[model samples]
Target chain A: MIQMFHVTKAYPGDPPVLVDINLDIDKGEFVFLTGPSGAGKSTLLKLMFLAERATRGQVLLAGRNVARLRESGIPFLRRNIGVVFQDFKLLPTRTVAENVGFTLDVLGTPRDEVRDRSLKMLRRVGLEHKADVSPLKLSGGEQQRVSLARALVNDPALLLADEPTGNLDPALTVEIMDLLTDVNARGTTIVVATHDATLIERYQKRTLRLEKGTVVADERGAKAARLMSQTA
Target chain B: MSVASKLAYFGRTAIGSIVRSPFVHVIAVASLSLALVGFGVARIARAQLDALVDALGGEVELTVYLAEDAAPEQVAELEQALTQRTGGEVHRISPAEALGRLATQLGEDGKALTELPQNPLPWSLEVRLPKAARDAEALGELSRRTRALPFVTGVDYGEEALVRLGLIARALEVASLVVFSLVFLTAVIVVSATLQLAIFARREEIEIQKLVGATDRFVRVPFLLEGLLQGLLASGLALGALVGLVRWLESSAAGPLAFARLDGQLAVEWPRLAGELVGIGCALGLSGSFIAVRRFLRV
Candidate 1:
């Protein structure tokens, strides 16, 4: 579960990026936060992921007031939340398998388990043969899959992706979305921020539409029941 | 696992990565090793020379010039004063004895006695100190005090001996300073460069780990271990190299270093050198990690 009440964030001498925004999502719900450029979607996701602190108000993640969490505790709090970036921030020096194993490595997982799980995840991403190669050597799509494997490695309860399909071809976009759908089906709450209108129109999932740092609509129709049931 | 064990685990991961690219790691280790080797050699050499000089103390003597036409009473009084001043147990070769020594040292043709009528060599009290001929400070102080004696016209410290002792002292002082600076510079370079590499190589990994619920300490712990390992390897190499150098000097150019030897060895205190290397390794390890982690942990 994720809840944000009247959260506001601003940089010095700049207008507020997020202005008194309030929202909530039940356990296991998959959300696509749709918005135009500069609509504070990424900032909202960042706040939820604990990458950036709320300038005001409280963010409660699974009943804990994370907005009040100290800087030292942020990393521990972030363990339960998975985040994927548009750029696929994989370590260039590390092989694809090593990249995926990083989350478990941070958790001090046993070497055997890290190896086995990393190999399995790479197999799932259809890049098992490329496991020993650096992520930088992989194609953008393959790298994205590696990033997904990395994010999902720790089996986080909450997942956030910033424009996950921003660079993918339409067919690959469909594939990536299907992959995300599969993850959601397994009951991981997902929040994806994107500006792609066609993808939003096609997926037909509950959309949180925002403009000028405020949510304009929370939409649902034919696919609402499926969306609700897909969550845990 | 505890934090330290977790650190060791991650440290193993990092070293595995580094060793997989053996060339870079080896070169890094070698550079530090060579620097430490040079430093250790220089340090050992100075210590050996100092100890050698210290052991040679009694061989050098003060030539005490007596007054012309000095009476036997004045001579006896001077000898008594000299003996008492030199802590009573000191070597005081009389002037006649000095002539006999000159004759023995110079041989028959070297005996100037036949050429000089008044036995021209002064009635000197050859105060042979029981210490080595290295530093001029104590000798110079003695000369100043003896010059104040009435029967003692002047204290003639062999000019070459004084000059040589002064030179040795200066050399020892300068060598210590230069070597210390060099070792310190090497440490800084080793630590700074090692940390810089860690920062650059793991920049993205560090950022990602932070994003994925890894704390600053978690991120820093492994790299610190890596730095420590590099330092240890470097120090080990340095110690090995220095010990090799000393052994080589002792067994190879035994003649030259024979002029200066400490504990019967050429250069370098092997045991102390080993300890110093290990100490430097630990220092480099902790210092490098501390600096790198502090910088990276900053927003």
Candidate 2:
């Protein structure tokens, strides 16, 4: 769960990137953050993850104020949150299994358990056969799947994916969205940031549309649910 | 994760990084080895100087020449006084024995000494100072005391030479310390720079690790281990090279050319020396990586 109250972030000599934003994301909710480039979607996710501090106002995660967390406390807080970067951020030299298992490794998991859990997560992402191959050798879709596996392997309470399928084809985008939906159904709250209107329209999840750093639309997927209900 | 598993992961990552970048590793190792070798040479030189000082300090002797007109009682009294003060055995050399020693010094020309009408050499008491009393100041004090004794003509202990030897020994000690410190600092800098390069190369990976909930310790321990391994390997290599060098010097023309035959006595204590070098290597490695990681970890 995440809550942001009137949050504003700015750099020196520049206008604020995000302004007076108030938002709440409940547990196990899957939400889409849609905007063009520089609409501050990434900045918002970064604030929740404590990757970037808010210039003003308050941000809370799971009832804890992120601004009050000590530097030493950041890593433990991060352990409960998983992030998937648009670029995948896979260590090119590491194999798919190693890349996915890196989170557990950092958590001091045993090697056998890490391997088993990592393989199981890779299987969920349909990349089990590519576990031993370097991420560099994988296609764009496979690489994104590897990133997803890595993010979800620890079963973190919250998942933040920034343009998870930004580099993939349309078909791959749908596949990734379906995987994210499955993960949310399993009770991992997910927040995805993207500018791809088509994917947002297709998935028809609770969408928060941003323009110029301000939330302009907070649609609760009622229309999509009605359409689905009629189709069923 | 257990501490053992964390340590194993760190070690494996360190080795992997080294294997992945052999050229960089070689450069780091070579620089560290050169610095360590310089330190090792300084250690050997200091040890040799210490042994020389000990040998020379033990051999310091004072010869007291008795006045020609002095009576036997006065001579006996002076000998007794010197024996008690010096805490060393004394040997009395008669004038005839002194003449014989002079003849031996003159070599084949000693027949001329035998042709003299009378033995002109003065009777002397050679007092060998105890090792503890052999310092330049102590020997000078002893000489001054002996000169004030009745029936004493003069005391000869090569005072100036003793003073110069003491100065040399002190200078050697100070020089060794300075050289060791400078080389140790150079080694730290070399290792730090080398580690900085490695960190820069892996900056992206480190950032990713941080994003993936890795603690600063988790990210840093591997680099520290890498630096430590480099230091240990470099120092071990340097020690090996030093041992081989000492052996070669002892067997080659350089052995006889050296100031002192640096055989077993002047050689370094291998076990202790090895332990010290390795310890220094580890310390250097840890500090170097620690410094190098600071700039990169700000992200």
Candidate 3:
């Protein structure tokens, strides 16, 4: 679960990126953060992951205020949160299996177990056949699946994907979204930040729309239709 | 994870990095070998210089010749004084003994010495000082003290040769230190620069590792291992090259090198030298990797 009461984030000599944001995301929930470029959707997810700190107010995760967490505590906190990037930050030199198993490797899981679990996760993403191939040789969608496998390998409680389908075509984007939905169905809280209104309209999940450093709307499932209508 | 598993992981990752970029590893190892070779050669030369100094020091002695008409009691007094002052053996050579030695030195032309009207050789006390007093300054001081003794006519010591040898030894020691420092600096810089390139090549991997919740130590251990492996390989290569070089010097056109003729083998202690070289290589590698990885870890 997460909570942010009056959180404000700013860089030096610049206007506040996220101003007076008040929000709450409950456990096992799948939330979509939709905003235009420079609208602070990624910044909000970064704060939740403790990758960034709020200049004012507290941001709480799992009932603990992460803004007060020490730097040394960040990694342990991140262990419970999986992040997938738009560019698919897989190590090019590593095989797909190695890329997927990296999270377990960081946790120092037993070698056989790491291999087994990584293979299983790759299978779930339907990329087990490509495990031994280099990420460089995989298609963008396949690489993104490997990234998803890596994120879910450790069974983290929360998943944050910043435009996970940004580089994919419509078909691949749907596949990625379905995989994310499957992960969410397995009881992992998910927050995906993207500007894709089509995916948002199609998914019909709870969408928090941001504009000018403020949450302009918080719509759920059917209510999301009204917000999209207003935007149009 | 258990320590063993962690180490295993680190080792595999390090070796994987090296395998992925053979050119970088090769360049690093070659540069390290060059630096280590310079240090190895300098160490051997220093050992040889020390041996030479020891050989020359062992041969140093002072001969205090008594006055031609000196009385027996005065000669005995001078001998006793020298023995007490130097804490060394003082052998008294009588006129007969002195003439006998002179005749032996003359070899084939000694027939005229036996027909002389009277013995002209003066009695002398051969003063053999300890090794500590064999240097130029110490021997000079000892000679000055002996010449002022009663019944002592003159003192003959290898002053010029001892002084020259001492100067050479001192200069060689300074040169060895300078060479060692220069080589060490060069090794560190080259290793650091090479590791910097290696780290840059793997920056994406490092960033991925960090994002996946890998501890800083977990990320750092692989680079450290990489540096360590480079250093170890470099050291082995340098040692092999050094042994080959020494063997070549021994069998070269000029005949066996004087230093390599130490009891029919090279003067350097192979095992100890190898150990030291490897230790230095490891240190250089560790430091280089540590420095190069620091800026990247900030992310």
Most accurate candidate by lDDT: 3
DockQ of 1: 0.54
Chain A vs. true chain A, TM-score per model, equals 0.91, 0.93, 0.94
Candidates 1 and 3 compared: the better one by lDDT is: 3
TM-score order of candidates, top first: 2, 3, 1
Worst 10 residues of 3 chain B by lDDT: B253-262
- Poorest stretch of ten by lDDT in candidate 1 chain B: B84-93
Q: Reference contacts recovered by each candidate, as fractions?
A: 0.77, 0.61, 0.70
Sorted on lDDT, highest at the top, how do the candidates line up? Answer: 3, 2, 1
What are the TM-scores, per candidate, against the unseen true structure?
0.75, 0.89, 0.87
Clashing pairs in 1: B44-B268, B56-B132, B57-B131, B57-B132, B58-B130, B58-B131
Provide the lDDT at B137 for model 2: 82
Q: What RMSD does model 2 have?
A: 3.9
Kindly report which residue stretches of model 3 are placed more than 4 angstroms away from their true locations once superposed: A5-16, A55-57, A169-172, B66-115, B125-131, B140-154, B253-266
Query: Which candidate order results from sorting by DockQ in descending order?
Result: 3, 2, 1
What interface RMSD does every candidate have?
1.8, 1.1, 1.1
lDDT of 2 by residue, B1-299 (tens): 66777788899998998887788778877877887888888888788777777666766788999888889898888889878887888899999998998899999999799999989889899988776666778778878987987778899987887787779887998888898888878877777887788678788888888887888888999888988898899889989999998777666745443556444334579998899889887887778788888777654
Model 1 scores a C-alpha lDDT of: 0.76
